[model samples]
Target chain A: MSDTGLNPDMVSSGGASAAPPLSRIQGVDKVFSNGTVALKNLNLDIGRHEFLSLLGPSGCGKSTALRLLAGLGEPSRGEIRWEGGAPATGSATDKGHRDIGFVFQEPTLMPWATVFGNVYLPLKLSGVSKAESVIPVGEALEMVGLTGFEKAYPRELSGGMKMRVSIARALVTRPKLLLMDEPFAALDEITRFKLNNDLLELWRQQNWTVVFVTHSVFESVYLSNRIVVMAARPGRVYEELEVDAPYPRGEDFRTSADYASHCRRASDALHGAINA
Target chain B: MTMSRPDDDEFIPLPGLTPAQKRERIARLVLPGLILGFAVLAWEIGVTVNEVPHYILPAPSLIAETLIKDWGTLYGSLLVTLQITFSALIVATLGGAGLAILFTQSKWVEISFFPFAVILQVTPVIAIAPLILIYVDTVQVALLICAWIVAFFPILSNTTLGLNSADHNLRNLFELYGATRWQTLLHLRLPAAMPYFLGGLKIAGGLSLIGAIVAEFAAGSAGSGSGLAYRILESGYRLNIPRMFAALFMISITGILIFMSFSLLNHVLLRRWHESAIKREN
Candidate 1:
């Protein structure tokens, strides 16, 4: 758990209770069809109930790593070993792994569906009827502070509200791991801050593992208990920083000297990774 | 701009139409009617003042009189033409959409059959109608085939494009959730394709009517169960120029009605979500 640990795949100190890692990416390499080396020898351990941010620049394969965790794509070289012997590699013939929820940078809602319908999608894919999903869907929306917007179409809502719906959809299934790829990057600063606070609050309450990919130092510092800075040109981990500050982090903590010091460290690591 | 209180978020009612919007709404209805009224009046005046013989160029009044005077025969023929048009449209919808789904399911199938669809689309229905009439046993079935041939291509092409156009992120989301292929098709692809399919339907509706009339002209089967086009042909032969104008008028009205009805259907289906159908604040 020490910062000076030599293993790049070491689990963060946030899960200090000695629970085994939820998943492990062991020597994963991703080479696209055009021979673009997206990831090179990537190794990381996702601790249970920990907010781990994969902070890096564009082309750093942070998103590629997230997608692999969600089984959206296969690693070209190595395997992701999940808990209890489940592997995260996708196969078209098998019923896909449903233990992961994902949020894209864009809201990515079904434009033709109502808010409830969009949020109910994961359960529906699992064969839960609409009549059966009302309570869980309502609860998910309420968790995101969007209860009254269940009937509104995505077009009628503001961008912030649409992203809220996207979050609600991701949370509805109550998945074990939530993978978010810069979900607030497209939003305004005020909205981004508000959502960041709400997301941290939700993560604390739900106790689900989250792997958030972002290029923003402040955002990574504010939300995550641990940050992994990754370098591009065949993306690999450069460094990991543990944000030792306590949680239930609020506006006061945001303005505190403690938060500034953590951001500065994360920013320095990020800059080093970018240069490397 | 007015500052809205945070508590008033639940029911931020849409503002009432401004004066300019009201004027625009009124002008939409009134302007078209006024121009049409003036044009008809001028035609009436020009015909009656010049004492032009009815055979050469029937006046508006004569055309209207002929419409009522021969409603029994004309109405029956109108029904016949409408039956062909609607029937062709329904069959075209089923066949075109079904084929498009099949095309999407397999690349090899699409590659094998798509060129035939393009060939059918590129060859003029008018040129093919005579050959179809020569082969098919019944003129009515031949007309239906021509109309269907004209209508189905747009639906197939548009629906294929729409199915392929589902958001890439959404598709990945569905895949992550372990959605079955059938579930993805039913929930995502079909609904996403609705607006495009409806656009194709609007175009097909009018084309079906045109195809029916053109096929009837080629058939020239004038004894009984003839459509409005046959009446048009018969009136022309007898020099009943006013009746010919009357029949032509019915065809125009029918075309307008088909286009308008399909357009209404499109708006109703997509008013809530689609950019083409939603009403923007500005």
Candidate 2:
């Protein structure tokens, strides 16, 4: 019932207009039709402008929680309501007016489409014409270091480059919420680290509420200002550890004693989570 | 900003090719042509030396002579055969791809009609041609129907497989973006199926030609308006073996040309992205 890591000052420090309670996920129970209880009695509030990571072992239902928030799958039982009673627009968009950006585990770019076309997909779905979408897509591509590769097919890209294109596509729409599921787990360590820094840069600049799911403690500590360690066997929230490491964490921070202590704390929490 | 065409990791270029690479490339083409020329020369000489009768096995020279002598008649017949072949292929492609899309749209439609498509595929075109000949008023229409039946199944099955093979994650992403059914079908499934449908089209090209010829053979129509198939039958009945060889040559060349054109189309469409189409160095 108690949140373990709370940095009272950090949320409002970065000029992040991200107010807390971006959404309240209360008592969510997700049971698949074949009867796998992926999540049980989960309650959490996603903070605004926060880079939050759901850290857990495999099968901890971190992805399941992300999926529910993406409006992809409904929980078998529970309620998820936005902080401001949904956006002010009554435009009657197809997806119940919840604007979200989602990144999957795979790069998942359209192989047949060029990078420009792939990034243009979300805008296109919202009925924006190709000519009209050029600026947004281009800006998004530039943000992810994929500006020159707009015409390159997915096959032309290395794994890291493809993932960059994917991230660009997600950010193109400028959604208020971004949900990512283990996006860099497949990349080599160096690429993952580089991407981590770039992603943090983007998060800082954009101030979008991020709910990232990952199995790495080091990653959660490095990127996230808040971490939710979840447990398996009917996956549920185990602890909320606030990574009080100040903003602009860089390579210097990576080798610092503070980073080591944070890693140690997350690892201990994870160890307890797996055992429990 | 300077950019190059996307580099292929699999491709490794050898430093600089001297005369050897040129020679190898030329040999690949010239060797086959030389062998074919040698074979034809041998056959011509063998026939002249052995004094073989024209009906028994006409020399290559005689076939060439007959082809030149009957140029106007043979050319018109070739055109007729080609017209039927192309018409049947177009019909098959449009019908098969359209039905495959409908099948993807509905499980009940696919389940109900798929076995019937299988039945149409397995039953011989020759066996069906006679019945079609009776039922269809025009001989051309009957032959067209026969050709289409044989060519239809490959495109249907291949496109269906392709439509189903869209990346699971990509489909999920599309769903996440709230792409409507029509949007998903148009943007995802159909494009994914393009390579498969093109592959099926290559196979259907050859089959369509064979179907046209076979159906025409089954019909056995002769004289002024007859196709190359009728020319073959007429030559056989009249014991004009040289003319028969000429007509047979035309059919063989036509089939090869059809296959090559489709292969070219597949290469053009897919070489940029598809793994099967892209050239690998390793």
Candidate 3:
């Protein structure tokens, strides 16, 4: 039930060469129907158990890339394959979908549903009975520190609490892969920083691969072991920088000189991406 | 830094109204009652002062006396109207909701039949009542049909709008999870459309009574087996003006009661989660 033991020392050593790719976007070209080239020749590899951040500006197709990875979208002209074969995507029963836990830019909780119902959704969709899913849903809620708030509606929760419910819903299925798209772009600085720490702690504890898409250089550098800076027009990877900082990253790391330097580098790459 | 624990300062009581809420509740009932009381008192005084003729406009006291004296006959008519109103309302709700669900299933069906529904809605029930009366075996069935036609459109349109108004992000989430059409409609669409459905039901409740009355009026002079509309007509012909006023009073009371019942249903269903139902300090 735990993925923590699968790849414990997954800290990247400034190289994508050591670990086998959990998935690959091989020469992916996504041309939207309206003649927008959202992504072109976007070749990237997802390192197993790696904390990867897709850093880009608004038009950089970072979210598009994450969507493709989550099997919520498809490349117009290239292959997205899993480790052994093509992404085994079908319905909720598919291997590709079951392996992923997606956190959207907005906390897309059902307004009428309770926290428990929202967290129980993925399992319920996969035909797991409510009775069978009770424990996992409870554990997921507890993991997000929302254990007592299970019966609360989304409207009752503040923005951050709603996001936590979204996270709990994502985590309930115990997915191997977690994909997020600007999940914290809407929060205030204090709440964002707090969530950043809580998220990193959860990531460290769970040991699942995370593909976080963000516009914030500071956020990418703080969370990702390797940040893939992307360019805008015909969105493509401009460069990749490994943070090389050790795990158990905390508030101390947030204020450290190395963290600021990494943020500077990531921001510079992002600006170059926006211009190019 | 803070989570919205149930024990937060929001101070929602476990199962009953809080003190402030109870006071607001009292104000809700008392304010409406005060307005009605003031208006009725003014009417009674105004009539007594002007020495208004009983036939033109009966005083409140006179109407009340007539109401008690004629209770046996008027109550029967009121029951008849209530039965038709409720039966029509139920049919409209079921038919409208069922059709809306079908529309969600396929755009073609909606495209094919929506215009016809619009036609039914736009055409006045009085204009259609004659045709309905000719086709149906009984006047009651014709009255019910007329009422259903008037009440059906709001529920259909509101429910359809609500279903279509589902958040794009949530729809994408459902698609991402591979929810089937049935599951999505049943779980997501139905709950999303509830507030809209209830809003429409409130409107339809009043409109159904109006439709029944109009249909009865159109039935005119001959259709006299049951209903307040007929009593009004019969009293008018007999020149029993007080009795006519009594029948009208019962009709008004019934309409208000129907409106209140459905409004209460809406409040109860949406109180916990809906923005409209949530009580704010302001």
Candidate 4:
């Protein structure tokens, strides 16, 4: 893998290590100037190829956590470390030097750009020559099942197609860590289910770490290897659940008895957090 | 509940055409065309029946005859008016886009300069035309400057709004990709601003013609070269009403020409990309 330089296996496995932790959040606190606490004393360790989700209700700061990780906002106190180092400072270019992909609740595809052009954006920013970028862009578009939509502008696409374009855009960079903030919340149920399954397939194939933020308990249960349930009003983690389901989880798994068990547990945890 | 088979596989054809659709298509053409034809007929009849004299109100046929007779002179003046309008439009587009970029970059500059732009938009160009003629030294330069001032503000205002109106979610998506400010402006803001800028261009196109005529009126009276406005003024003073009507008809035709040119440009630029450009097939 091109990312072997930052191999997570080297750090934890007692092997000769070239690099360190892929991402580390320690003692992070976020308080606005207006004195509203968003995240409190947060600590998280995300290794390469892990699928972790921050599951919470509205105002629980799941999106805020994602923003902090993306370096869109700074932690009020403490630090976010990428590759076992402090967040980069100075110019926005310098800040968060690590390659990070983000998808918002909305598709956020550029209305002016065709699907291919939108996918080509990060590559263009990295100064990848157009010829060099074509294959990777094509592969990413194919991965998202948007193969023939290369020339279709965002306005011409339906909501699902737009979101697929957004996903393709994020994947074009092949970033080590993908941060998605409630990306499927706006989708209809069937589209949401299809996207969820497609996303997991992509995750398994790429083996990239994903930090997904979502308000849906079923979503977090379905897609995450681990779910971190957050409480509202000063957003703190209320519970952590490790989903023991095997890899390459299929649509069949969604209807299995185990899926219901996980959902029930998550719902209980959420209720407990709200009450507490 | 069983998951409804994804509508993804369904290809719903466009709705069937009905009597209503036919009626709508016919009405769209007939309503505007009929109203125009009726108005022209009334004007022709009123002038002939009331014996309003050709000088007072030349019939449409006489106007057409005058147009045919004076086609060469009128055509020359029309080209001059077009030159002023198009030149002013180009200058306004470049100037407006440049200032909008600057304003987007700095809040202080926007706050300071925006009010001055508003003042220019509201202030009468006729009031300033003589002053511009006196200071500009050349008649063409004076006319260009006057038209530019009149046409510049809409583009600036519309473009700035469009640039700033990028969706917050899209802005975040760009930031997440670590796009530089310049990259964001070029790839995101500028493309997003196209519709608004083009809208402003349409409005400015008409204003440019009006401004050129107004400026020429003030300039010709101040002893500048003879433009269409001067011909109209001179013909009216000499009680040459047919010639004055002819000049008025030429000016209206000039306005229509300016409008058609811009409408064409809008269609060409936006046809494949925008709903506003799409003509209904039905």
Highest DockQ against the true fold, candidate: 1
The Cα error of candidate 4 at residue B26, in Å, is 7.1
As for DockQ, the candidate ahead, 3 or 4, is 3
Candidate 4: stretches off by over 4 Å: A1-21, A33-35, A84-98, B1-31, B275-282
lDDT of each: 0.86, 0.84, 0.82, 0.78
Q: How would you encode candidate 4's per-residue C-alpha lDDT over B60-133 as one tens digit per residue?
A: 88888887888787777767877887899889989998999899999999999999999988999999988888
Cα lDDT of model 2 by residue, A39-140, tens digit: 988887787788889999999899999988887778899888787675322133542233688898999988889889899987776677898888888888
Task: Name the top TM-score candidate.
Answer: 1
Candidate 3 local lDDT, B1-282, one digit each (tens): 222232212323324568988898899989999999999999999999999999898898998999999999999998899898999999999998889888877999999999999999999999999899889989899999999999999999988888887877777777777777877887788899999999989999999999989998888866755799999999998888989999988888888898989989998888878888875664
User: Which ranking of candidates, highest lDDT first?
Assistant: 1, 2, 3, 4
Clashing pairs in 3: none
Q: Please give, for residues B1-282, the per-residue lDDT of candidate 1 as tens digits.
A: 111111212333224678988999899989999999999999999999999999999899999999999999999999999999999999999999999889888999999999999999999998998889888888889999999999999999999998889999999988887777888899999999899999999999999999889888988853244799999989988999999999999999999999999999998898878889644574
Question: Candidate 4, TM-score vs. the true structure?
Answer: 0.88
lDDT of 4: 0.78
Error of 3 at A44 (Å): 1.4
Question: What is the C-alpha lDDT profile of model 2 across B1-282, one tens digit per residue?
Answer: 111122321222223546876798799889999999999999999999999999999999999999999999999999999998999999999999999999999999999999999999999999998899889888888889999999999999999999999998888888787788888999999999999999999999999999999999999853234899999999999999999999999999999999989988998888777888654446
Instruction: Rank candidates by TM-score, best first.
Output: 1, 3, 2, 4
By summed lDDT, the worst window of 10 consecutive residues in model 4 chain B runs over B1-10
Worst 10 residues of 1 chain B by lDDT: B1-10
Candidate 1, residue A254: CA error in Å?
1.8
